[model samples]
Target: MVDYGQAVDRQADEINPATVDQRARRLLRADEPAAANAPDTHLLQALSLVLTEGASDLHISGGAPPSIRVDGALRPIAGWDRWSPEKVADALGSILTPAQRVEFDKELELDFAYTINGTRFRVNFYQQRNTVGGAFRLIPNEIKSLPELGIPASVARFAHLPRGLVLVTGPTGSGKSTTLAALVDLVNRTRADHIVTVEDPIEFIHDAKKSMISQREVGQDTHSFASALKHVLRQDPDVILIGELRDLETISVALTAAETGHLVFSTLHTQDTAQTIDRIIDVFPPHQQAQVRAQLAATLRGVLCQTLVRKIGGGRVVATEILVTTAAIANLVREGKTHQIASALQSGRTQGMHTMDQHLAELVDAGLITRQAAEEKAMDVEVLKQLVRRIDPTDTSVGDLSNGEIDFNDSFSPGRR
Candidate 1:
């Protein structure tokens, strides 16, 4: 087999020759301005610096000069001329090998991870109307803490349990993987058991501490998720982490992994708690719906419906609707009464459970986040208004709080979004 590390190093070497200063717009003084403008490997070197400086994402396109997103804002990198379509194509073509480009062409796009300056980037390179363009999201070297992320104490409770399934739900770029990494890190530090993670081009890197970790990346360490799931059972794993439950086969395998003495962690693209469950069950054929519901009812440990709400501190806070499957919740799920799970969560807070609205109300009360953000992300508005009501009964009137706005209420609605 060829060495990818060496191939990546070649790119690194190519980048170093240009000495693109990521912190500044200036290219190395030694390189000719005309050649640098033409497109070269040094762009990756410059990207390496931008990433090291904590830029959230980077974009290269046909009409625009290369741009980088730092702290959620777009800032133009100085010293670069307006890049034409040819320049954009040259920059992308220089890095993508002939084979990679062929594959990318066939797919109309490609998703892969590339490393430079020891920083890993989740890259999506593709064509746009016959023009080349790409975007890269920086993945940090260290896993951030849940508490550091201002994740509720209850969300952390998902990691403390030893078995069953925990699902993290959020929209794209909503910190789903980072949240999962925090939870996984929690287990890695506190538990003494075998943990296995199956991912496509694995994101977070975990160092073995109290727990042993086996990370399998698709197309590299394993051929597919189904095949890995087929063999992980004999590996004596105490926990199994699936990157995303994309297909029915993997979903079935994950539930089986949980049912047979293992704690399972996975993420899904869903807005709220109820929708998340619906999407999961919908993945299966109608013929097997009843059985899958029964299986989920018996083995679901929790479902953390979360979103990265803009916080008053200028970053973000995680307001999560956590569903810890209690006897009532399990019964509701088993009997095809998933809607009742929200009420169960609201009343079960003493047991470390909370609906999203409840959590949102708590954040607003604590002055951590605004109330407006809650209503906009809310799946059920009447319920959020009700929760605010309980916070202030005399102030029965409510206003929109979806855009970082807050207002108190007295009538607490049983809304689980």
Candidate 2:
């Protein structure tokens, strides 16, 4: 049997380039009798590649060479052959515990955390086309601060609030979990209170600093999110972090938790602030919608909607739409006038509230990302163009507002393009 411990301990930089392909071919040989019983050497090498290349995720599936998502794009590793169905299953299955194997066989899917050489990953194994596939998301060992993550300074205020609901909403793989971890870290460093988090397979492990932290994994610590949340209030928590407000029951309980004077942090799969608010309200039955809206207006502190955009040189950066609830915005929520929320965000920049397009323009102006990339991610292209023009009145490449003509070929020169 291969010594998995020694293999995992080897530094990624130590891998000899000349023998990498030979090692990969030998490890992937179909005749290996113990392939199903031990974690494949090739799988460990691919994970090491993820670390060395600064990739966010590793994808293993049948009929494809292992691929890593760097920045925001997927690039298949060179010098590796396409994996067969058996090869994919053997590599991924070797990592699952016997109990997890039973569960996966019963449910056809599984989600859990795995740690190797002190680096943790959030892993999901699923069946597709009668074959197994896996996705491994690398969780950084060190949690970053909000400023370090390029988040706006005003977002730190959410951590200071004694009570209310703050949400970080975005699509999958949009760094929602990382941002939430930063906020929780901030609270842990600055406050003296009890913080309880309910996560499905717990991503970031928190060490209690000034705050006492109790992190519960859904399947391991409790039956489900609803069950954990049902009893969390009785645990005397001052701050609650629901990993993702994924269901109606979870959302309802989170609202109650926030309403009853506990600061709540959660994530939603929504594009922007308006949609996030609407998603919560719409989750309830018609009879409960009005009450939920009122409850949301009263307890909602802020919503931060963010997306990852490819940066100018390499890597990726975040573009965000932040909504800091005010009397006017609260009234709009209560009155069901969410469509008008965008205007409020546009006018509320002094309060640190800005629409997504506005921030996209700022990122383009700062030369952190290109104008074309910003336009692609913008909610309204015309609005983005107008904001870019407003930032630099002398730039004609953004197109004359009088006639809608844009020059996409104009290389983004930061100061005056």
Residue-pair clashes, model 1: 20
Kindly list the per-residue Cα lDDT of model 1 for residues 42-150, writing each as its tens digit: 4665575453333557788888767766434566555455678897778766656555667777888876666543556677888888888888776666666776555
Q: Which residue runs of candidate 2 sit more than 4 Å off their true CA positions?
A: 1-36, 390-417
Instruction: Summarize candidate 2's per-residue lDDT along 1-417 as a digit string, tens digits.
Output: 221111122334465764654544444433322323656777977976775555678999999999987666777876678999999988898877777888899999999887765667789999999999999988776676777676787889999999999999998888888889989999999999999999988988899999999999977899888889989999999999999998899999999999999999999999999999999999899999999999999999999998877765555677789999999999999999999999999999889888999888877766566789998899999999888743553443421111111111101100111
- After aligning candidate 2 to the native by TM-score, how far in Å is the CA of 63 from where it should be? 1.2
**Candidate 1 error regions (>4 Å):** 1-42, 45-54, 70-82, 97-99, 389-417
Output the number of the TM-score-best candidate: 2
Q: Model 2, poorest ten-residue lDDT window?
A: 407-416
Candidate 2 overall lDDT versus native: 0.80
In lDDT terms, which candidate is top? 2
